[model samples]
Target: MFSATVLWLLLAPAAVSAAPLTALTDCLTSSAVPQLLTTNSKYALAIKPFNLRLPFTPAAVAQPTTVAQVQAAIACGVAQNFTVTPKSGGHSYASHGLGGENGHLMVDMKYWTNVTVDSSTQIATIGVGSRLGNVAQALYSQGGRAISHGTCPGVGIGGHVAGGGYGYISHTQGLAMDNLVGAQMVLANGTVATLSATENPDLFWAIRGAGASFGIITYYKFQTFAAPNSNIVYSYNIQFTAANYLALQNYANTTMPAEMNMRMFITSGGLQLEGIYYGSQSAFQAAISPILSQVGNPYGSTSTMGWIQGLSNYAYMSLTTPIDYDIFSKSLMTVAVTPAAAAAFVAYYQNTARTVSRDWYLIIDLHGGPTSAISKVPMDSTSYAHRNALFKYEFYDRVDSGSYPSTGFSFLNGWVASLVNARKKRGQKADGCKVPTTTFGMYINYADSSLTADQAHNSYWLTHYARLSAIKKSVDPNQVFSNPQAINSK
Candidate 1:
């Protein structure tokens, strides 16, 4: 077999390192290095934070084009007894992607951002580093769009799919991981492998929702759907009293026609309902009429736009909307957790936000259409378990820390507390969802990074925990992949 190092020497001579260095320059030798990174080239190569920045630094960063180079980098780490962390977009909040101070190397996957549309199968083979914006544009050009994360566009496909990505189309399309058909990964042992439903079924099942603990995903084959004809109607519904709760939920639970996607949220303002549909203005009116009637309130705006253009509408005001579609595609930057103190967290953040501003909101999206059905394969067959939820709930705070740290802090606390209180009042256990085990569950991607091992197992595929555990032991027995969000390898 051809050696990975030999292959790397031929493809990227710069990545051919003999001795280590204190900084990235001591190792890199490629011309492509300039093309693959941002201004703080060396700083960008370090994995300083994982929940909190650790005292570690990568010896260097390698931006590889092919999986062979990824394999080579891993092999080098293995040979040098150094840890390797693969990052396409540095969007992780947890330290999962952090390589620490003693780290051997940080394998940058940005150069692998390639997307190919397979009209024959209605599938798109996306490079793991590819951002959502490019994927949307590519699919739009092909006359189709996908169900993916809503706001942050720069989120890399690898982490997004690994965590069961949710987006505006979630109500209709289901989580991002559910749409995956195949994956190419570099194992901890330095093997470049392909896993899919029909191929390495076991690995495929493990990677769908719990991919970070498994391996570095180089590419993903995702199922796509027909592009919508109408523009996204961006609506912000504000209500101050909790009286509108049941009214909003009831309307959302019943009025969601498969043709129209609905997202319902209980915010500090009161109750909010949002959605996007696949039809003419008249049809869109028919779908949301019940919601409009139930709430009896005014809204933000309704405009028609391209599928990608609609995505741009939802960009959070805090982050600059990327002028280049591809730049914004790399969403999922900081993966910070809400403080561990749950009750104090709720009391301070939740109530404070409501008292301070009537605009605090919980966002939801209705997406996924005919192509969004759960696979006939058993629940254990894939990593993603939430295949039935029609809407995805996203709660966020827009307070600026430099100008208003207190407000920002309060907003986060309040936002988290509202979710906790709502779930508790509904009789949900700290570990489980109020929804039944048989039907409803949490989206792995949206799961708070602060969640405990038991909380993750209970909220997701509770029954399959033992199986997933066994798979983790078999593949990563030493727990070399250990991180706060990792599966406990007991």
Candidate 2:
């Protein structure tokens, strides 16, 4: 009876007109355009009202509340013969997630933000638009928690999962893709399907890492763990010289024990290290003392807090406050540098910032507890092939449309590329100081969408675009969910 009722609801006279969006009025049903935009647009768009957005505007935006509603929206888009884009948190730098440049419809998943736990099965069913802050707060209060995610917390799970979410716990839990148990997605053809390991395994495998190119995901299920009970000591701050950077990097590569969740961030200012010890303060101190000795100064202060509080501390240390949607919307860059390295970076950055180009700097965060267990799944099960990884890296820089300098942009990119090449060359010796290829893969979530086909194919040390393309084909034969960074459908 419930199923029939749902079907009836889905079949009800389309509450929204299925007309092609020939004019703005076709999408904005009410005369109140300001209200619609304020109420409907995602965080990034809403946050910076003055942002120079895409030239092509969306005719209408659909805020769906359920899987049926999502299907209905897709059907209406198909019927209207308009292109549609899926928006979770709108963290994407490109216009791919939102309707721009030929796309006429935008599916907003914010209304579907719901998180629930299946106590019996220990699975958490998260809505597509659910953000990390809410997810963490909810789970922590209920004695359940997820592995690390984006620091800001406003990023949506749909895009995160589809692109391969990684966080502080990534080094331990593996990618967020590893914990996803099932998902309910609305396909381009308006068909709704639920995929899991035991059911539709192929689709499940594809969605785990490369789901964005297939459909509009409404809700997803993940294997959850009991939240940590103890208040652990977290040592965090930004202060280190370039001389200490190599030592810190080497320590990160070796000295960090399993009990400590450690991540280092280097930028123009200096080096900041954030670490959380699952055990007591003394235990943490004893475990981390060897590495701290390298810094040659006592840590500024050590605060003890619960897991939830620890998250907040980590946020504060990173200069971010939890759930500040507006700030998070604009805070996209995360790169590494030391005071010694700052001059060169500033020379590149100041010039780029003055120009009208969108390039950003992101740093690698390698913090993981026992919770984020590396995936034991087969390498070929999904397109994401990185099996054993310690950390993932991402960097960003925003540029206004008209102010972008193409030559400056190329120089900045090339400069970074040169630095990476140098590092790769230094680590190339086969026998001594071998850089683990498995650990050398890029984090799919933070990959530059602007990279050419060849770049994306060659960037990751482990996974190749060919394998990713095959997975994309198997899941989305028509490429309905195509985007700049998405695997090409052929």
C-alpha lDDT of residue 113 in model 2: 76
RMSD of 1: 9.2
User: Counting only residues 3 or more apart in sequence or on different chains, how many pairs clash (N, Cα, C under 3 Å) in candidate 1?
Assistant: 39
State candidate 1's TM-score. 0.73
Q: TM-score of every model?
A: 0.73, 0.74
- Model 2 stretches with alpha carbons more than 4 Å out: 1-20, 23-56, 99-104, 144-147, 231-233, 236-243, 295-298, 317-362, 367-372, 375-378, 388-391, 398-415, 424-441, 457-464
Predicted candidate 1 versus true structure: per-residue lDDT over 1-490, tens digit per residue: 4333222223321322345542344223432332233246455333333222122334566677866667666665555555567766555643345432234466777777878888788888888887777777766777575555545776667778787676666555556777788898888787777898777788898887788777778889888877666765646565533334444444444555655555555556454555566667777777667666666656756667767666766654322233210000001111111233223423543457557553335454443223343322345667665443433445444322112223344444345445454444555567775644323344455444445666656555555667778888887675555554466622
lDDT, model 2, position 70? 67
lDDT of each: 0.56, 0.56
Q: Residue 400 deviation, candidate 2, in Å?
A: 11
